[model samples]
Target: MTEQGTVLMTYATARLSDADIEALGSELDRIRADVVASRGERDASYIHTVIKVQRGLEVGGRTLLLGSLLPPLWLAGTAMLSAAKILENMEIGHNVLHGQWDWMRDPEIHSTTWEWDLVTPAAAWKHTHNDLHHTWTNVVGRDRDIGYTIIRMSEDQAWRPWHLAQPAYNLLLAAVFEWGIALFDLELDDVVHGRKSKRELFDQVRAVLGKAIRQAAKDYVLFPLLSGPSAVPTLVANLTANVVRNVWAHTIIFCGHFPDGVEQFTVAEVDGETRGGWYLRQLLGSANIDGSRLLHVLSGNLSHQIEHHLFPDLPSNRYAEIAPQVRALCGRFALPYTTGPLYHQAASAWKRVFRMAFPSHPRPSHPRPSHPRREAAAVAPYAMA
Candidate 1:
């Protein structure tokens, strides 16, 4: 193995003191307050409308798919179902369940009771994802999402022989990303290492099993059988739709956090962090995807992953509205605002996966970019986190 903690780091050129950090926090809070104050009928209408459309699409697709006797019908049905599942899983379910709309205080949209399309129960996932993953976005060790309990996502995670199969592991995980996330929610390593009690682990298992069984029966069994002789077609179409949703979710998510320029941090980096420090960490650690309005909606507006990380509790729809402001803030701060199209981000993430499969060394530093006003900020890995 190579020496640890030797990576070259970069930071914004605008030199910041503790007072400046607090001022940044204050400015962010102002933006947040504005968004929160603006929340009302429009935000509520957006989510409800999205949910309605998603449900309608799922039903229409299932109906057509159930009776499909030709390839064309099957294809059309599969497309609709795929779109529905994507909307449900990404735009509607994920954001609503984030309690992003919970400020309205409606029972149905409340975070505590919202269940998602994935195999993992919403409660279990929220505990691990919202509470844990968001709490520690790109920290090498503390964030289990760094590699989703499997791949080696950062240099700090020592390369292991098993990681050699990551390309295969990653592909399989993409195919069944929902199941992979469910299993990760259980933190299997904790069970094997005795960090979790047998009773607690089994309880989680039972909850997951219940959700899995329901999901399987709905798409694979009940829906198929309900179609009688057309059961075969419906089953296949449903399976295709689910796979499409899984792969899409996996790709979008991986692109957001694992792309080339996104920084990874150590726990020490965030020790006793203040509000501005936390905001800076989120800005540095997260990446974004450039895309059209439709792409943004279909990706659950997580295409604005940088804004999402910076304001996770804010309504996801608002990410788009506030992205320009956020970008402006990044420019003013001279901080790196990592973003690119979806394909480039995906390629970058995959490249990292392959490169990090084996042991690697710290990246060689080059001279900071030339700037007239000040240093052209080269993003440092953990220097400012």
Candidate 2:
């Protein structure tokens, strides 16, 4: 068997009988149903409270920065701003744009209305991230998020000499992750491949530039200028905060998506996928961070990446509640529940980044498993989500 064939055969989903897969899907659906039924004031209050706290931090940070010439105030203000940006980007903006809070019927916090501090427009992010990424997850070719169309992420993806710099640029990418995501979300590669029109790309570019200008003006111009004698220090502080937020967001995201034991899929592997099969793929493809309640909140509950992938629109707060059940389900099914400390997971993900930067030699093959649904040629290799 080929290396690719071996991968398909060993995937946790491939060993399950059709009836077993159906049963797994049914149980997952039950979990979702229960969460949906229980969603109410508690969930609403959780999001509202987070939003208030984030705003207060931002306000306090900016107020302190007006006197940022004082080293102590600069340090305190910058730290608060960094924390505020992280909270907004990870907890509030991300989850809100995922429509996690839409069930509350509050237009003020609806996905359609919320704009993030990042350069990427919410609509563009929703299309690429919510529509394409969440649906496809770690499917190598279809999910542009595999490496954001830049870095080499999977052995299934062909490597280039340019990838040799991924280890270095990967660090730069982390520092400017919001910009990287904004560019990635534009789907420029799709335009090259004729999957997206140049005209569409042009319009998206305009939207990105508009958002970028506003974000730049706020953080760089308006706030700094408002500081008068402390303008330069305040400007430096704002820049530091944004970079800190970017690096932290990148770390949390990479830890969840690329860490050891997180599986990548081929389109062929997912062809004609059933509900249970989808659940299985998500479970295997996503790894979680083992952390406290604060860490969970800061990650927008994406520390529970498996549960988030399984039920993307469910309330973020409910992830912790459902996590034990999901882990138990994986245990019952004899599937891997990939979770570890943040440091370990982050290190594993970074190790993969460096490893994939080099050429990937084929692994020795194993006999193919007798999967009832392994239709390796049923779909085109580059099938879009």
Candidate 3:
């Protein structure tokens, strides 16, 4: 290992005995089968419940209003119960939206068609999330999610005045505008900044506009017409649910990859690296959060981020089952497995945000390019989070 906390090339090339590798592979397959079976059963019930509740609110508005001013706190608590429904939405709902669940029975369809029938248009999310952010992750030039006005992820970007003036305030801004940040990306960076081509920009613009119209129809027109004055409480319930859900979603996502130990590389660096090397860097650079089985399940097992990186095509439900094997592999190879509780990781990520927002010194030039073999050879193990 090198002084920079990167695993060395020797470690990367080290092979476990063939029997151990086969055993690990077999263990992963067994876990995948279990997850698929369990998830299939749970998700069918989950989808039915969501459909029933949404329909109940729509059809029996008066009865619902008379019985409870808002959704029963427990029902409405989908927002505040961050660990429960929000995680459920992320794990189960998201997979369903992606058509990753039972794709053989119902093949994966584009989000544009109503076949998916997501609460939100799955296409827009696929474009921003699966296509852009997941593909690029911490690459500032490409990943729209990380480049907030003041909380820039890349070290190459110049610090703004407001960023320098009030560091804590910027973080507060991030927390408050987390939902809006993605929208801003669609409008500003992706469109106005010319990051996207003209055709792609127009497509995104249409998607965003369509989503706004659908939301307005539901929140403003349909609900008010149905519930009269009682609609106020219903609106409140919906808004509260949205707030809770958004907060949970934002917090889980932000903490996963943005923590202190994660590195933000320049476009120049990323452009120069080989695909395999880049994948390895992403594995080394991202941090994972620790949580319970439900938490792991809900976050799409993204807390097992390293495994996810290593095997993106594999279902997330398989992550926890494969985690120990991956950890053992890391241990045998002396790779640092960076992980911690959610808040601890979040705090660390926030500090990095602060440093990016208010740099104490001028930014340095990009590092000179080096040979891949030499680069791999010079690597040191990352510190465990």
Candidate 4:
């Protein structure tokens, strides 16, 4: 079973009993405890090494771009810059901001201290992503990442005429995902609906603008200008590199969340939820990408989305180490472990984008009752398209 439409509570009811769920949760807790206890120098070294490599790539890429007038240099420089951006945004920035390395007592790498190389401020992202999105996971209305409130990602989401253009715009979103994420972190709908104040919205917008301008000046102005005669080519190379990073980040993220067999939930399903229930939801709701160590590193180890979702603050390097235990736990529980290769997973997520653009009835076997809270939460002020 690659794709599913049922909410998590109903899915769980049909599979595991409450006692079984509790047992599963206990097992998961043990796994987490083991990892937390074993975290040491090896894990610390992995993150530091990644950071060093990323900085080297960025420096080398910019140096090469200074001679971007040469075709080979332009290609090589652009590739290196793209890789560096991906590493910063994914492996280092994302995990560090998740407080993955805070146990090291390294103030420089602390979540509260590190600012990412994106248009969104670290604080804003932590609120929306680390707080809201992670807490809510795949809950239909509560999680804003479901189609990012622009494209239709779940059957529970009401389809609109605008979604007809999702297949096209989703492509644009992937190319400029950093900007899309910056806007998404603003929670514009909350401001419109009075859930968030205009003052708060204004403050966030100001922060975003500040970050955007700095990022623009650094990439579009300062670096390009430093190249003098190669300024135009350097500018283009930087732009190309950013686009490449954005697209790769978008693809890896979508693969982790939207691929086949990944489940979604209604708010009702999660009501009075237990820790085990949350674990089950995370396990069922997330999909994984089957890839190599290099692929995992480039993805910030998010290829093990299930593990990351279950242990968001765990070091990225450990997800691979613990993946087998997680998979085995799933096997023991007879729960589905959804995973696929990059191409297949990416295609599956995109297939959902196109397929869910049009209206369709819910599956007859699991008829969904009205969820007023879920419905209201899903409603936004306006469609982007």
Candidate 5:
């Protein structure tokens, strides 16, 4: 049977007793309280100030070039920097708005109608992200992230065209349109999962198209005319920055579940399992990443993806503190727990993608043996889902 099918079959049969569910709930509650207590001081005020300062600097930098104090090449460079800043605002700041930084306040209230301009609708991050991706991770019929058009997660998705040409196509796609693909997922998921009425789906498509057009006009026409020819260079720079930011986001997200050790499940498997077992699968089938304290702070410590899945509402900052307890719990359950350095985990995920896309391609069959100055490990048994 295919891996996804196998996972579904296993999930269908697995059962958790009431005591197990209660224990899982108790553990989650304890972790939530600890996270809130420890990271409660994350004032959104300071974060807002930083964003404003960055925007002001970008504007002033553009104005300087327009006034002829700075060269055109300098203007172009500055514009690119500004664009990067915008991408950062979307990726990093958006997570903060999700209360990945602070859970005391409702993110929706702060994100949709806050005085502080801290949200990005471009990524459609919340809908495809917080709602779908996290909630239905690795479930082929449900997890929007796994529906790679050119890449298959398991043998079930294997097809002649994909087997023949997907590797090269997927690599280029990942480099250029990872963000675009993620955006596409929002609509595709609704169709695939039958989440929308026919009329609602059509309306959503029209709404998205209109939003895209308006954004393009604002970025390409209005901004250039207002800022002068310098805005052209700025636009290019911004585009490059956006690519970098998205690539980072894609890499970070992929590592959580795409590494060799992680398992992929089908709808049947997940449906068969109890809530506690499903939660355990999410934890065991995911990997953790480790880096500097500041890195964890910036990326929402999503390297600790299992913990995040298990305790979605908890502040990310608390992942480090709960790491030991989580490890102990998994050990007690005899469940596998995987972790590694950031690059190590990322490389593993990337390699897995390559393997899935190009079956004949030869790469390291295992995690890199060489220990870099900083290396991450991926922990998993050699069992298929």
Candidate 6:
């Protein structure tokens, strides 16, 4: 039987008792320990190989595009540069800064030192993503990643008329993801609402601008000028490459985190969560994309996002190795193991964006003692869509 099929069959028969749930946690821990213990030559070789391949593509592509007026060379060079950027940002930079391979003891690859290709500073990303987002997962008010503080992702969020344009802005955000992320790091929502001081926001904005200027110079100014006669073509090529990388990363990330079956939690659901409950929350909050080896690598193995969230510090390469086991655990527990092909998952997430743009049933929220009878505590009267 296929791995997913087996999981389904198991879930058909098993019910999760307290004993079974505790055992499930233990089994997951056992697997994590085993993977942790076995991180050695294989892991090191894998990361080094990816880095070499990415660098080679970047160099070869830029060289071919340099001082060349050939249309075919421009096409090939742009494609190569896109591939290189995607690999560098996703497979290398994202995972490295996740501290996945810190056990390798390589300072160059350590999370503390590595910066990504994107405009968002690595330190800011670690604070918002690693520290806040991961810790909060899908908790509505707690996780700023819900709609990235822009779009209303659920009914729990107080919707404003501006959300009517979210579908449009969502596309825009995908096109310019790096910029959106850099802005997100500044906590612009808080800044505008007086939650964060303007002075502090200004300092953060300066840091982002500094990084942006350096990156822009490297791609559009310094490298293009180095190409001499091909300066224009090279600059345009870099621009296209960056855009492609940004869109692909944004798509893959959305597929993993916001698809149809994925659940969003309220603060109450996660407020007092235990270790096992936290694991369960992560499982429910994440979805996975089914694809070939190439897709997995380009996605930085975030294709196995379920596994990644459960063990965020684990080497990303190890995710593929552990996915089946994780699926089986979900099956044994009779919990959902959400997986879909890339297109399907992407479509599902977008559908949510569109569906949520309109008003809907009241969302489940924790009752505040002061507002025990607030109307959101129960669904409003039904109406045709």
Best by lDDT: 4
The order of the candidates by lDDT, greatest first, is 4, 2, 1, 6, 5, 3
Model 1 Cα shift for residue 239 (angstroms) = 0.9
lDDT of 4 by residue, 214-260 (tens): 99999999999999999999999999999999999999999988998
Worst 10 residues of 5 by lDDT: 367-376
Model 1, 296-318: lDDT tens digits are 99999999998888888899989
In TM-score terms, candidate 6 sits at 0.89
Q: Any runs in candidate 6 off by more than 4 Å, and if so which?
A: 1-21, 193-195, 365-385
Model 6 over residues 69-157: C-alpha lDDT tens digits?
Answer: 78888999999999999999889998898889898889899999998788888988888988889989988888999899888887788
Error of 4 at 297 (Å): 0.4
Each candidate: what lDDT? 0.83, 0.87, 0.55, 0.88, 0.56, 0.82
Q: Report the C-alpha lDDT of model 2 over 240-306, residue by residue, as the tens digit.
A: 9999999999999998789988888776667667667778888889999999998998887889999
TM-scores for all candidates? 0.90, 0.92, 0.69, 0.92, 0.71, 0.89
Candidate 1 Cα misplacement greater than 4 A, ranges = 1-15, 362-385
Report the candidate with higher lDDT, 2 versus 6: 2
Question: Stretches of candidate 5 above 4 Å error?
Answer: 1-25, 37-39, 43-125, 189-198, 358-385
Reference-based lDDT, residue 372, model 4: 29
Which tens-of-lDDT digit does each residue in 1-385 have in candidate 3? 3325332222122323323433444544454465556666554555445445544543443345333345573253323333333544566455554445443354332223322212334566665666666667666566666644446655656667666544565445444443464365464554566656889767766866677677667644665456665566656654555465565565666776777666555555454344444444455556788989766865766777766755554555656667787677557644467789988987876676667765555346444433333253433321111
What C-alpha lDDT, on a 0 to 100 scale, does residue 272 get in candidate 3? 31
Better of 4 and 6 by lDDT: 4
Clashes of each: 1, 0, 8, 2, 9, 0
Least accurate 10 contiguous residues by lDDT in model 6? 4-13
Reference-based lDDT, residue 208, model 6: 93
The worst-scoring run of ten residues by lDDT in candidate 2 lies at 1-10
